[model samples]
Target: MKTRNLIYRYLAIISIALGANFANAQSFPDRPITLVVPNPPGGLVDTSARLLSEPLTRVIGQPIIVDNKPGASGNVAYQFVAKAKPDGYTLLISYSGYHVGNPSLMDKLPWDPVKDFSPVALLTVSTNVIAVHPSVPVNNLKELIAYAKANPGKLNYASQGNGSVSHIGTEIFKQNTGIDLVHVPYKGSGPAIQDVLAGQVQLFITTPPSVMQHVQSGKLKGLAVTGKSRHPGMPNVPTTAEAGLPSFQLESWVALYAPAGTPAPVIAKLTESVKKSLALPEVKERSDAAGVELRYLTPTAMDALLKKELPYWDKAIKSANIKLD
Candidate 1:
């Protein structure tokens, strides 16, 4: 009798908890929502978050606060959101570099991108541009490779960090072309681009939006864009494929994530909000002006992408023997 009573109580408690969770999911976001951006202010990640905030807020009928926590090469912020309560109140704007690529590049991670977070949406993609200081004698990707091989480690490339798209893409370039160049890692793209412009670094592989003005002004030499095709912002720059490096192309991407256990209904609601926000005309215009391609992927598709990207990056990182503390 005592055992049966205990079982009955346990089942009743589980039933009640399920009911409460379902109810909460249905009425989710009664209060404000926090979107944690994993980069410093003034960069693309922060800008993307700020742009999406108002539209998402309006769609969800709640105020969306963007919190910037830029450190540990994106670990500080991503881990923060990963540990937050899975209550639909906290979300993360996960960059492709740290969210997916870090697993391969870093020796350890504060949180598992695939396991600790629910993929809410795959937001946008920005093609990375490869540019050089004008003083360098390289006019294009082929010339850069020849120069790098002839000069060996004399040339240095600037990247956001050890595992950033700039770094990974550059590393992949070196691997494919068999060139040797030193890597100079920065905390963010802003500082990195500054050093590149000042000629402190010879090569900078970053997004066109960050270097479009300098490229146009001839302060920096735009060698190639990393998309499969040329970027609209830098139409004059050929793509890596066209620049004779088809295997060495990468595009920086952004995505939305919630804590792993966030309720399904709440995730659905948040995904819906993302779709709605992306559909807004003003949002489209702003994203285009920012040199971002606004592409929204469903949660399932986002998850699939994460899975697909992991192994390719893993192979590259392993080949390069790259590691971050």
Candidate 2:
């Protein structure tokens, strides 16, 4: 009789616990949700975050305010989310630099990039392009490589900043091909592309969105893309493999994350909202316009990608000895 009574009590407790979880998930965002961006205002990352906010807010039935916490190479925002109460109120807008590339650059980070957060959904994947000014004598990647080899130190390349997507990618290209070109780090892509357009910088490996308009307008020449397949937006540009530089492939991506220890059901609700937001026509259009390919990768897939990319970038950044200012 005592055992029977104990079993009944245990079952009741389990039922109540499950009910609370269901209620919690249903009642999520009882208040405003903050999406923390690790970029300053007006950058691509910040712009993408704001674009996502509208659709996500509608799907989640709450106000989603974007918080820009840019500094320390994304550490400022990352640390903020890491230490936040894991109550689903705070979320981090994770990108390649903090999630994937920082492991290679920083010796000791405040939080374990892998453990400090729960992956929600992937937002964007940026395909990088190798573009040159119109004045360059090369039309394709092959001729460009030949010309760069012949010119040696005469060819210079531009990157957004040190330890950035462009910096690490271009360095890998030089490492694989044994090319000796100068790296000119700019405050951002605008200045870098300006120099390239003015015939001051000969080459630039940048995100398609930043340089695509210039490429389309004939101000910048598209040589090749650092993707496995050609991008539809720029169908004329060949893939790295097609351009005979298979070893030089690099892409940057962004995702949504919540602090670790958040309730699983809360994560599930946010994930569902994200999937729905990504499916919306406006979100798709905005992402494409920003030159971001929306993959809507699930949490599990994003976790797997994080694990895979960490080691790859670690090796590349270590070998390149990339130091950010």
Candidate 3:
């Protein structure tokens, strides 16, 4: 009789817990939702967040705030979101460079990308563009390679940080082309681009949005874009293949994530809203204008992508011998 009574009480407790979770899911986003970005404003990650925030606010029926927390090569914001309450009010704007690339680059990360966060949706994908300062006498990729080879270590390349995609990608490019350029790692793209524009750093291989306007203004000469085809916003630039360097290609993606223990129902609702927001025409227009491709993936698909990318980045980092710690 005592065992039966204990079992009844246990079941009742579970029932109440589930009821509370369901109620929370139904009333999710009673307050504002914050999208914590790992990079400062004006970069691809932050731009992606802002691009989605407006439509997401309309769809989710609450204010969407973009909070920039830049430091330690995206570890600060990542760890911040990872430890936030799993009540679906705080989400992460995850970047592929920091997400897949960090595990291999750093000795230890404060949080696990897969374990500490729930995959919400994959937002945008962008390819890097190789931009040289106007002072560099490189018209295209072949010219840049030749110039770097002739003047080895004379040019400096700026990266978002030590283990960022720009750093690894530039290293790989050096290996492929047998050219040496000193690395100048900055805290974020804002500072890196500023130095590049000032001719303090001669080159930057980064996302198009970060340098496209400067290229258009002729302040920065775009050598090549690292994608299969040309970016619509920068149609004048040749692709890596077109510029005689097919082996050197780099792409990055951004996604949304909730804290690991967020309720599944809440995740489902957020995913639905994201899908709707991405489908909006204005969102598409803005994303194209910003040089980021709007590509949406469901939670399951995003998980699969993360699984596939982990080993790829691991190999790339190993090949480049990149270590941040």
Candidate 4:
């Protein structure tokens, strides 16, 4: 009789807990939802968050707030969201560079990208552009590679920071092309682009948004885009393949994530809202203006992407001999 009573009590407690979780999921965002961004305002990640917030708010019937928590190459924000309550109230705006690259670059991380967070949505993807100072004496990708090869380490390349997509991508480019360019790391894209504009750095492979206007104004020469096709905003520039370096390609993406233990029902609700928001015409217009492609994947698909990219980045980082820790 005593053993039967104990088992009954345990099952009863579990039932009550499940009932409470279901109730919470039913009323998931009774209040507001905060989207925690890993980078400061105005970059691609923050831009992607703000772009979704307006439409997502209408779809979810709750206000969405964006919070910027930038530091430590995005580790600060990653750790913050990793520890947030799994109540579906706090979500992370994750960037691909930090999500996949950090695992390979750092010795240890406070959070596991795969284990500590549940994928909510895959948001946006943007390809990087290879731009050079006007004075570089090269007008096209072939000429640029030839010039770099002839001059060797005389060309200095500016990256967003150490372990950033720009840094690692450029290293990969160097390995593929056999050209030597010195690496100069900056805190973020703003400083890196500023120095590039002032001719303090001769080369920068960054997102089109950062260098589009400058390229248009003739301040920088856009030699090639590192993707399969040209960016709509810069239709005149050829892709790396078109520019004769088919193997050199790089892209950065942003995604949404909640704490690992967030209930499945709540995740389903959030995913539905995101799908609705991405279909909005205004969202598409704004994303185009911002130089990012609005690419949405279901939670399962996003998880699959994370799984596939993690080891790919690990191999790339190892090949590049990059270690941050």
The candidate that achieves the highest TM-score relative to the unseen native structure: 4
Candidate 3 Cα errors over 4 Å, as ranges: 133-156, 176-179, 186-202, 217-220, 244-247
Q: Which structure among the candidates has the greatest lDDT?
A: 4
Worst 10 residues of 4 by lDDT: 316-325
Q: What tens-digit string does per-residue lDDT give for candidate 4 at 1-325?
A: 9999999999999999999999999988899999999988887899999999999999999999999999888899999999999999999999999999998888868899899999999999999999999989999999999999999999999997778899999998898899999999997788999999999999999999889999989999999999777999889999999999998989899999999999999999999999999999999999998899999999999999999989977887898788663
lDDT by residue for model 3 (224-244), tens: 999878998789999999999
List per-prediction Cα lDDT, in the order shown: 0.88, 0.87, 0.91, 0.93
Model 3 clash number: 0
What digit string (tens of lDDT, one per residue) describes model 1 on residues 1-325?
9999999999999999999999999898899999999887876778788779999999999999999988877889888988999998989998988877777766767899789999998888888888999899989889998888899999999988777788888888888899998999997688998999999998998887779999999999999988877878788999888988788778888899999999999999999999999899999999888888888999999999989888888888889777774
Model 2 per-residue lDDT at 158? 96
Using alpha carbons, what is the TM-score of model 3? Answer: 0.85
Residue 126 error, candidate 1, Å: 1.5
Model 2 residue 101 distance off true place after TM-score fit, in angstroms? 1.9
Indicate whether candidate 2 or candidate 4 has the larger TM-score: 4
lDDT, model 3, position 57? 99
Candidate 1 clashing pairs, residues 3+ apart or interchain:
none
Which candidate, 1 or 2, has the higher lDDT? 1
Model 3: weakest 10-residue lDDT segment is 316-325
lDDT of 2 by residue, 6-123 (tens): 9999999999988976787678979899999999987567877887899989999899999999888899999999999877889999888778777677788787888899999888
